[model samples]
Target chain A: MNTDDLIDFLATRVEAVDPGRQDRLLTLAMAGSLCLAALACIFALGVRPDLLRAMGTFDFVLKVGFLAAMVAIAAHGLRRAARAGRASGKLLRLALLPLALVWFAAVMQIVATPATSGMATMFNDWFVCVLAIPLLSVIPLVVLTLVLRETAPTDLHYCGALLGLVAGGIGALAYASFCVNDAPVYVGIWYAAGLAIVTGFGWLTGPRFLKW
Target chain B: MSREPDLEALMRASQSGDAEAHRALLQHVSVRLRSYFRNRLRRSGAGTDDAEDLVQDTLLVLHTKRHTYDGSSPVLAWTYGIARYKLIDHLRLNARALRNVQIDEMDDLADVDRYEAVDTSRELHRALDTLPRHFRLPIEYVKIEGLSIAEAAARIGMTDAAVKIGIHRGMKKLAALLSEARP
Candidate 1:
């Protein structure tokens, strides 16, 4: 068929679609993603803690694990969002806020407890920083809030926001374990710097590489 | 024509239960399916009402039989098969309706003349193409995909106000472009 004829036929058919049915399908697809994200979280936290700890300390391990989980969940959410005919670019952009927040909080913790020369001081500082990452985790939470505010009608955004929080929390824990050092300022600056680096990577590569 | 096909990556993502890949596949295929149904309706001489029902039925079938869509084949072809079936069903239904009425009992052509208005599909697409990329993408999601403003906003990383404004302005620009194209 000619392009014009094709366009007319599609527009008519699309208009005929039942709004309720579309909504239901979208919801079902998103639910599937949520299930996947949950499984990923369990795998990262429960099954692979030691591997994550090897990256840093126990606390750092947990934070990294959390971030890894968030990435997994966001990936899952992106799939569901696509099936429902949601925009992928916007979803990823919205996802960035939470990732940014988790990274920021982790940096803050490292800043508060600078590692010292002695093994005891290093372990103590590392533990304290790890503890603080989860407690002061707010960037992901804030990012989620912004997503919610922007996409008020769709429950999918909320799903994304919650997934972000979980992912960010785990990520922070993981970073704490592997990257502990002596300077709190270095941790804070570099951690924030690290997140900024990730954000840049996500922005530059996310659009091209992450399209599902 | 400009969009790249990352079939291997898409398949891997789908297999691994990547939600974004699945969603992208649906959106990409749905556009082609709409085109398929639209063409059939025009050829069949069906009015807008018949066309709309046909489209909805096609989508329902697609969703139900999504598992049958083997990743090995082109997604568009798979979607077209389902759409073709729905169109044939519509034609059959119409034939039955016509048979029930005698030739002399048929409604006056003049009375239904308004329903026979020229299809604006080409004009719409042309107008859409003329839109700036920024405006066009949102319109594609909101108007074509039938997503709500909030949903579109979330997907594009813009606030609700921005999406709404973009759609409004886009519609205005589309109207102008279409009007200019009209004889």
Candidate 2:
């Protein structure tokens, strides 16, 4: 086909862009996601009674720090992922920085508290931690996908991975309040696993749902 | 006259379901992809129809993905990215399929005539279209179909010398046609 004729034929099928579509859609998506996750956390599992005490410890800061960093960095990537063929090359590095730091802290934490009586109990509820992170991420994942659908992303795998990071981070953050255990190693090991599972899910779904 | 050839403006109008704007956008995108698809297809020695097929498929992709175009990025980069990805997917699928033929059944599939007439055929390949049937058939059997000159001569019922000359003249004409196509 002649290029001109082909273009004319295709252009006739296009629909107009609505004013302020991207901004309006994203704003609602984030707000709705947070509200939904927070609600689920409150009704399903109340915040740990000792959350204030947990907040005062350095471990709380470190644990929350890792998740918060993931959320902040991944959110930045979400915007760029909106463009086709564009992906944040920094996402992996940004995600790893916090995780590595926490892992280091976990090592120090174990060395400092070795052979403690409560050490055996630390691994208790480990399954629950793994289950809760991705389970809790479902709503945010759905909500983020709604916004993602509105943007044109070319690299579906990278963009989907970034979305997974963002949704997983939010889930981990919400779960932090209910979680009383602040062992850096546990957070490093189990929490990291949970996030990985979420990220893997994102990668699996990227090609199917993020085609646009 | 049309106000101006504004792709972004056309995209904006397209979001509102305007067929005129959609047509303009498709034309603009197709003009760009013509070169994009041609470059890759030519590299693989694929026929011109392959390039047109890619363009049409891209147009459909753009239509389906129309809602995702946010207009914040350059339209060329956006469409070009999509075209590139489509090319990658096209190559990936073709590569796998071609691999089995090339490795496992190269002898049997060697020189298969892709130019054979099909009932549904509607367009001519630019390079082959200009040659007369006699010249075209000889060249195709010898070159594209991988038949030796004697083999082609036996098949076409012509002397090997005449078959060789037909192929040579046909090739010269095909070259002229291809050269003309470039500029």
The CA lDDT of each predicted structure is 0.46, 0.72
Which candidate's TM-score is highest? 2
Model 2 stretches with alpha carbons more than 4 Å out: A1-6, A9-20, A111-121, B1-28, B60-73, B91-183
| Residues forming the 10-long window of minimal summed lDDT in candidate 1 chain B | B110-119
Candidate 2 i-RMS: 12.1
- Tens digit per residue, CA lDDT, model 2, A148-181: 8756677888888888888888888888879887
lDDT of 2 at B17: 72
What does candidate 1's lDDT look like per residue over B35-108, in tens digits? Answer: 67777777778755455445444443443334333344455544554466456545764665465445543465
Q: Where is the poorest 10-residue window by lDDT in model 2 chain B?
A: B115-124
List chain B TM-scores, each candidate: 0.46, 0.53
Please tell me which predicted candidate would have the highest lDDT against the true structure: 2
lDDT of 2 by residue, B21-136 (tens): 77777776776787789988888676555676677667756765666667677667778877887777667656655775677655444223322322222222445665798787
